[model samples]
Target: MTTVAAPTRRRGLFATLGDIYHERTNFNFIGRSRIWLGVSSLMVAISIGALLLIGLNLGIDFEGGTQWEFSVASGNPSSTQVREALKDTPARDARILTLSNGGVRVQSSELKTADRELVTQALSNYSKVDASAISIVSVGPTWGEQVSQKALIALLFFFILISVYLTFRFEWKMALASIIAVVHDIFITIGVYALTGFEVTPATVVAILTILGFSLYDTVVVFDKIKENQSTLGREKGDSYSSMVNRSMNQVLMRSLNTSFIALLPVISLLVVGSGILGAVTLRDFSLALFVGLLVGAYSSIFVATPILVILKEREPRFRALRDRSGPSVSAVAVESVVLDEENVMPAATPNPNDQRVTPRARQSRRGKRR
Candidate 1:
């Protein structure tokens, strides 16, 4: 009797690349959701702890203080010079900052008119400038409170709009998942601000809102893909809901990463070149928030949002029935015969055709056309 060879084939050089970069990846994301959720839980917990303990470092705009700005033409003005300039005045011990245009910004508690004039003269004399050259602005606590209130209102309005839109556009489950992911990004970003002690300015508030939009956009894209795949590919392939979601995620993973990476380049330039090298303090506040938010937004769109959707959708009666009746399709367990390799490849249990619950929409349409 002659021994027969079992079928085996070598993967092409581009196969792995195609699998990873072209949405053919089989990364078990839905299967390993517990790990992702666990990691996110830890991050959220730490963020909550930081918020409760350390708290955010609000900027002068938020805290309500007097601001003095003046430029120096001759020498390189340091924070030390600004401190010394205020040393003799009631505004001494103020927070000193270097502006992008070689100016100094000093912020301190509200000062009396006489004290303000005295401080102006001190800064003018220290910098060898006229008293008229120094400019002062004062903010009351009421203004800061108003800003806080407006920011809160904007955030609330944003949440409401997102919830309503997602609920109608897809389903309540998708809306819930998107909202949870946004909330996750917000807590993490705020926690980072608190932990790093970065001053929370109005620009920071704007950046936070911008990131929420970015996060939502990414999540909606993924959700849309999942919805498309569920109706078409999932029905044709007899894939369970979780498997279908995983496929959809892999398909869009590269696009999400590329979009995020391209977006980060400009924000990174603002952070490093504009802020660090050019010494624009405001750019640092804005770019840092954008950078962190973009990264978290991308991650939540993939790992957080998709997994949560799978969990929610799998509980539906239709998806649950599909999952319970699941077995490897004949196409998934294809076997081939090869002359070079003698290996026995054990295929998975084949699915019974009668047990398949989902009929492809195309097939249904064809049947209706025939009828």
Candidate 2:
């Protein structure tokens, strides 16, 4: 007795995860660009709304304040109680937070020496500790305002330099697309923070700047591939500029995913272990900002950047002619039919030989050759 051959359908580990590392997917990024645009627009609108309505919970770094630091030895005071105690003093708008390391941070408006003493006394009474256990950090409003102005200036300069560099490397269309994607990432990240009421601190500002660089890197990767493909192999018959952009994104899809995932792993670990477990608020803030920004940055790079590039490039005389001839309704379908060869990993559009009609002369020639 003999066994039958195993079915070819059975695949190993690499084949199961969408073959993401090995095979290219024919996902029509540009075909579904309208959906992406709609989603991004809606997100941007919601983000803008949150920013307008809720605003960020600015930390002492951004909004000048008087901070009274203390650790509880025995008892605790609720934020409401602390605020009530300070209501009669200059630290009237006191906000209290329980630190992760079993500590208490009392942030408030500027306090006079007398008010400060009153706060210390109140905290001492609440915590059952001596008044000497209090620590104070007072930042002038001028410093906070200056920091804010400097951050804005840095962001502005970053945009200008990035635009110039991208324009030089790729083209104005790609530069525009990348800028739009970066802006989308920024607004989405900021909006999420605003909506969540996360404390916006100097660490958060640093994270945001870092996110800008990460987003630009992702955008440039996609753009670089698109530029190379468009210049080299995009002249194939029945291929549209939109499809080429989509194809380029697919080519480097796994690379972007891997890079983002690798980057996020440590950030997530810091958020969970270093921040949550170890009571590192700075790590929490930085990692949280990075987590949101990296995700949004990846999304905008693939969906927003390439799609906008296609839309912009399609307005050009060459691409306009191509679009007119291919027709929008049918071009995407045509592009989808062109499969990427698995073995060669390149675009294939050779017409089916069987689909060609054999005329009388051709049939005679074939019969003669056969004989």
Q: lDDT per prediction?
A: 0.83, 0.80
Q: What would the per-residue lDDT of candidate 2 be over residues 215-276, giving only the tens digit for each residue? A: 99998888888878887543677666776777777789889999899999998998899889
Clashing pairs in 1: none
| Span of 10 residues, lowest total lDDT, candidate 1 | 333-342
Candidate 1 lDDT tens digits, 1-371: 22344555655546655655765555566766788899998999999999999999887777898888888869888998788767878988888877776888888887888998998888988888888988899988889889999999999999999999999999999999999999999999999999998889999999999999999999999999998987764455456887777777777877887889899999999999988889888899999999999999998988898889888887889888777666752224322211122234654455565675767665344354444
| Each model's total of backbone clashes | 0, 0
Once fitted onto the true fold, the runs of candidate 2 whose alpha carbons sit more than 4 angstroms away are 1-18, 75-77, 328-371
Give TM-scores for every candidate, taking all chains together and pairing residue i with residue i: 0.78, 0.83
Candidate 1 global TM-score: 0.78
lDDT at 140, model 1: 88
